[model samples]
Target: MTPTRRGPKKIDYVGAQSDGTKLAADLPAAVQVPDDAVAWTAVLGESTVRNLHSPDWKTREHALQAVMRSLGNARWNAERSPEDVWNTVTQLLDKALKDKVAPLYYASLELLSTLVATYSPNLPYGVLTQGLEPLMPTLLHRVGNNNARIQETSIQALLTLANQPALGLAFLAPHALSAIPKKSQSGAAAAIQMSGRLELITCMLNVQVQQQMGFGTAGRTPAAAAAAGKGGDALMAEDVVRFTRPALDMPDDKVRTAAVRLVAEVYRTRKAAGQPFEVEKMVGAGLKPALMQRLA
Candidate 1:
């Protein structure tokens, strides 16, 4: 009788290799996939939380995926208190955001973006604010990460969180205002990082501008009375202009260009919102020359 033939064994899960080289594989199909009704408690199990901080990058990446998948699939409830879950997830993600590995960093940002998108509408404002307070600073710092993908992901994550009612100008403005790099501190690499930070701040301000003008995600213009009723602390145009003033003087063209874009966006946002503050006047005579030099 001919010997029975068998194919190579399939990997249902990733395991450590003998040579210590990381395996480039996705989590196995056998892994439990969370359904639409999965609870946060089940997803944030002990082992899963532990793996999120594992020494192995792949393990951490897989843990991020599990968390993200659960959030994406789970049914969120505004009435259900999410403090415990929020704290646990926030702590893990904070570490993950600081992860040196590029893939893990991006994954962390994706997970964060998912969490904010899923729960912002349902969760209480104070609860979300409490959870994200520590995170916002870390995120602002990560916006300057060396990896381009990480920078972009970090920016997107910040905007996703900020655009929601739970987090707006009141929460984000201070962090953005403080993240500017000193001219002496920014070297060749730092210049690029500075540009990333400027870009992110510009995007965030633009989101606020859109909302203030009643051009929200739905893009329906509300009545004048209702437009002013959109509650939250409006971002001070003067503060942002002052924040970017240093960037206007930086010798690096990229940094200067980003700064110019930021200032321009600030002016445009004010114009669109019909805000009373004169941003150009706020920056004094220097604003025009800076704009002209760049335009020239």
Candidate 2:
């Protein structure tokens, strides 16, 4: 009888080869790649970054997929070093986020959100500090990006960045909004924009209270639990009183409700923590006046 034919051994297969020299043979003849591909990250990472910037959407999609997969692989610890990943991909992300192609921009933002969620503590100090701190001004500028999808995406990115406490407080401080002068009038085109911003800030205040209460996966520093880092302690109220005026004065119903909820959440958390709070007084003093001003 003739000898039975047998399938090729698994070792002979070249797909996603664990070793390099063998895989190299499978690449197209005209495609040039580095010889030391066993160093997977070095070989594919640069190419992946390049593909993200390529004009073709297919190329960008494949590159983003490759990056997503690499971020999950144990052998790819290089991506965990946030500084290195930032250096490799920052320019590409900035361009892609601004790309006319919606998918490209959305995917780019997803990558950043992933970086923040997965690599928070490990992210490079200088990169996180230098890169993220300047984000609010940039985001405020881009608040009018292509449309609501991009605007919402920008807000999500900002929230993700705020997973870092210091970064979060940097933007939430009243000083951050001090630049936008208070607008008491309505019917101006800016009213619509103003409403959206007030709603966003209200969301932030609630989140800060949640984070401080340990209801979140992470939280801000203890100083966040108090109101003062200044003076002889007369004005240190353990809450941001100055900003309450703007939140209450916001003409939007949702904005006022959010502002009340913010105050309520702070009251709830402080009570739980055994810290003193004057909910009635703050409401009477700040909210009542602003409500009257809003109606009148």
**Best candidate (score: TM-score):** 1
Tell me the TM-score of model 1.
0.70
**Candidate 1 on 1-296: residue-level lDDT in tens?**
99998532211111212111122123343333223213434537756754654556688789889878766553633333466556657766655665656677677778887777776666665676677876776676667766676678778877776665555555566677774544425577567657777887788777766776666642111321133243353456777777778777778887888887877777666666677545456666664564655433
Per-prediction backbone clash count: 0, 1
For model 2, residues 1-296, the per-residue Cα lDDT tens digits are: 99998532211111121222233355654334444422334435557644554545656666876776666666675535556655444534444444445565567677767655655466544465555433344444333242666667766666665555433443344433444433323344234444445445555555666655566633254432232232221112344444444657666665566556555555665577697765555555444654544333
- The CA lDDT at 253 in model 1 is 82
| Stretches of model 1 off by over 4 angstroms after superposition | 1-43, 72-81, 181-184, 217-233, 272-280, 285-296
lDDT of each: 0.62, 0.49
After superposition, candidate 2 runs with Cα above 4 Å error: 1-46, 79-81, 141-151, 164-189, 217-290, 293-296
Give residue 110's error in model 1 in angstroms: 1.7
| Backbone clashes, candidate 2 | 1
Pairs in steric clash, model 1:
none
Please give each candidate's TM-score: 0.70, 0.56
Query: lDDT: which candidate is best?
Result: 1
